[model samples]
Target: MYKTQDIAVVILNWNGIELLKQFLPKVLEHSGDAHIYVADNASTDDSVNFVSKNFSTVKIIQNSQNGGYAEGYNDALQVVDEPLLCLLNSDIEVTENWLFAIIEAFNSEENTAIIQPKILDFKNKTTFEYAGAAGGFIDKYGYPYCRGRIFDTIEEDKGQYNDIIDIFWASGACFFIKNNVFNQLKGFDASYFAHMEEIDLCWRAFNANYKTKYVGFSTVYHVGGATLSNTSAKKTYLNFRNSLFTLVKNTDSKVFIRTVFRMILDGIAALRFLIQLKPKYFLAILKAHASFYKNLATIISARKEFPKRGNYAETDSIVWSYFIKKRTKF
Candidate 1:
């Protein structure tokens, strides 16, 4: 059985000193005996010095440079010897006893390799957060949606998803994983830099026959888009590009067909942006496809290294369900 002290709550920060100041206290208070760490991505500001001076109990890991989310955590976690890792975002406000249910779940399930707590919007508090709403699941076309969120529609929490269940992916906002499984999977793909890398990690885990779960009893409030706003075209580019990277690297069967279909859907989305007068976003999607083409050979080589498993997606097309059928609630 894992104890409270066995978990390391590592927060990845990139010059977000204000976020650290706002949320770090609650994490320290509610996280029990779990070690707290601030993994700095070589901040140019006074973030490192501020943490060192104010938060004496929190340990600091200074990375050589800003490697974004994927590489930052990979570099910092090399020295974290704890049995469990809680990859908390710097902008999250964790609740009291947040570690209890997660620890209990880990102790009870030997096959469970990763987990995520219930994430609510920090601003509204009643609505589910966009990042990882109950848990994350992907459609066959590689579109990711959460139980309380699908596309742009987010549902209000009414105790409907307050149950532990199996999940396809855990959000990086508050991800929990066994150290052994993480090392075995070789961590997140650094090529991604930021977006969809957690899903990539979880997909790899699923292929390896490990379970990823959602513990709704434990909760955290996430200030979504704290670092990268939804309005940014750069976020669009990363989401579109990294998603294709993940689909190619881990999708079960008919890889070529699925990828082609997924790209077609992406083209439709890009055209929608054009109709909406958002040329930047439209260009972002086109750029994303160019990057995907450039890196396709390397991604296919990575696919050969892993064993593919059937029944990976929750639905064949979330696009069809959400857009066509208007089934917004997951």
Candidate 2:
């Protein structure tokens, strides 16, 4: 058994005591040499106390307040001295030797600064999870989807996408990055609060010439929507709004034109939501656009310090490919 002392498995928690109670044992058991820590996000619940009492060996970093995902990690990681950081979610379950494969890749792939392992669904172990299927890719329009997943469709794990490959983004659910690379990238955009921040960070990394990859051999089962339910209006709002924020901050000179087209596409999507009788979702899109337009100035200012990178998208318009051309499988 190879001992990897450089790795630190840190779980950012905000009142997820049950999830920690359920999954932390496997992480402690299976993780060979990496130290484990729970960065509590000012949870009012008994989560911090529980971990301190039961999991006495697991280190606890009690944050002053809940900063969601982006800022929570940014603050928690300030004291984590490990060279490699595994930002694991509380709702995920790891298999044996998972850390070994990731450590091995980090050792071999010098330029691969960020990596995400094969994330499968905990409910149905054979199927890919919605968060990140077989790595992430964006279309020309800035919409993100995975290899085994296109929009709402998730493919089964038939060992088809079992090869390590470069990705545009890694799922925040089980994200890994070199400590220096993370600090160099300035962590995630705290304004994002949560959803799509990982994509934004990965995009910035790509622009800086750092590669993100998917290691299919190391697998973990994720209970999707443990924090926020998938159908929640807040989730919808964050996805739509943060995606626009990402596009504006990361895209090149064509950002204005893309924003125009994207807004129109979003309108079409809202109409589809209405047709499906999901009024809340339709309203969510509208709210998202309103929020984006309101924060346009701030979002643009956020991009001033960062340089844009071209040739980032793998395909032009995943919406077109999925809807008009009916290309489901990636």
Candidate 3:
């Protein structure tokens, strides 16, 4: 088993005092050997002070400003010297032996650098969470879906996806990665700010020949969207835009052709939103494309930094599979 000192369970927080109050105790109690840290993102609330006052054993790292998820972890992780880093969200609850399961996987696997445990919904424990159900996989079109979650359909935890396996990406909600791998990649793209950044990081790892895995033996419950709600227009904007940014920066071969097809699919999504009487979502897709175009040069320049990885998608077209073919359960 890996030493507790080698694994630092760092939670990135921003005005989530209530969440910390609710979930931090379990993390402190159940995380037997791993050291815990509260990386406060310059919260105006008493979340930092509360952690400092009550959880005296847990280390606290305060950033000057709230940098969202990507930069927040990038900044806080700089001071951490742990060999293994668990980037846990503030809204998650861990079960007994969760850390042990993750550590065991890393110790047993030779090339595995990133791992995500099965994520169950906190609100409904029986169902898989939306963030990263069993594990994450991307379609040929750069659309991401999970083994237990496709589109809006989330599967119940019937132990179907219980075995450990290779995954295209890991959930940021409770992501674990090696310190060296993270540093070599220079951490998550701060430009992402939040949302889909984990998938982007995992894709970069894939391109570098490192593996991402899902350990179903361990499980954690996530209160999805504690910081940003699922229905927020801002969330919609980030998901759409960051996903495009990910494909541009990481996809192997035929980048231009793949991106063209992606844009067409996005247009169809925008029209669907308009038909659903949600013009904000429609405009959000347009805004995402506009942002993608504006950042084209920078995005294209990122390709030079890393070699083209293998086609990591499990399916060719997730949109067609889900909408046209009606294959919702993954």
Best by lDDT: 1
Off by over 4 Å in 2: 1-3
Error of 2 at 17 (Å): 0.9
**Each model's C-alpha lDDT?**
0.95, 0.92, 0.93
Summed backbone clashes in each candidate are 0, 0, 1
- Tens digit of lDDT per residue, candidate 2, span 112-184? 8999999999999999999998899997678999989999989999999898989999999999999999999
Write one digit per residue (lDDT tens) for candidate 1, span 1-330.
Answer: 899999999999999999988999898888878999999999999999999999899999999999999999999999999999999999999998999999999998899999999999999999999999999999898899999999999999999999999999999999999999999999999999999999999999999999999999999999999889989999999999999999999988788899999999999999999999999999999999999999999999999989999799899899999889989898
Q: Lowest-scoring 10 consecutive residues by lDDT in candidate 3?
A: 1-10
Candidate 2, residue 260: the lDDT equals 86
Which prediction has more favorable lDDT, 1 or 2? Answer: 1
- TM-scores of the models, in the given order? 0.99, 0.98, 0.99
Where in model 1 is the C-alpha error above 4 Å? Answer: none
lDDT of model 1, residue 201: 98
- In Å, residue 49's CA in model 1 sits off its true spot by 0.6
Summarize candidate 3's per-residue lDDT along 1-330 as a digit string, tens digits.
466668999999999999999999999999987889999999999988899899889999999999999999999999999999999999999999888778889999779999999999999999999999999999877899999999999999999988999999999999999999999998999999999999999999999999999999999999998999999988999999998999989998877898899989999889999999999999988998899899989988887798777679999999999999999898
Q: Return whichever of 1 and 3 wins on TM-score.
A: 1
Candidate number with the higher TM-score (2 or 3): 3
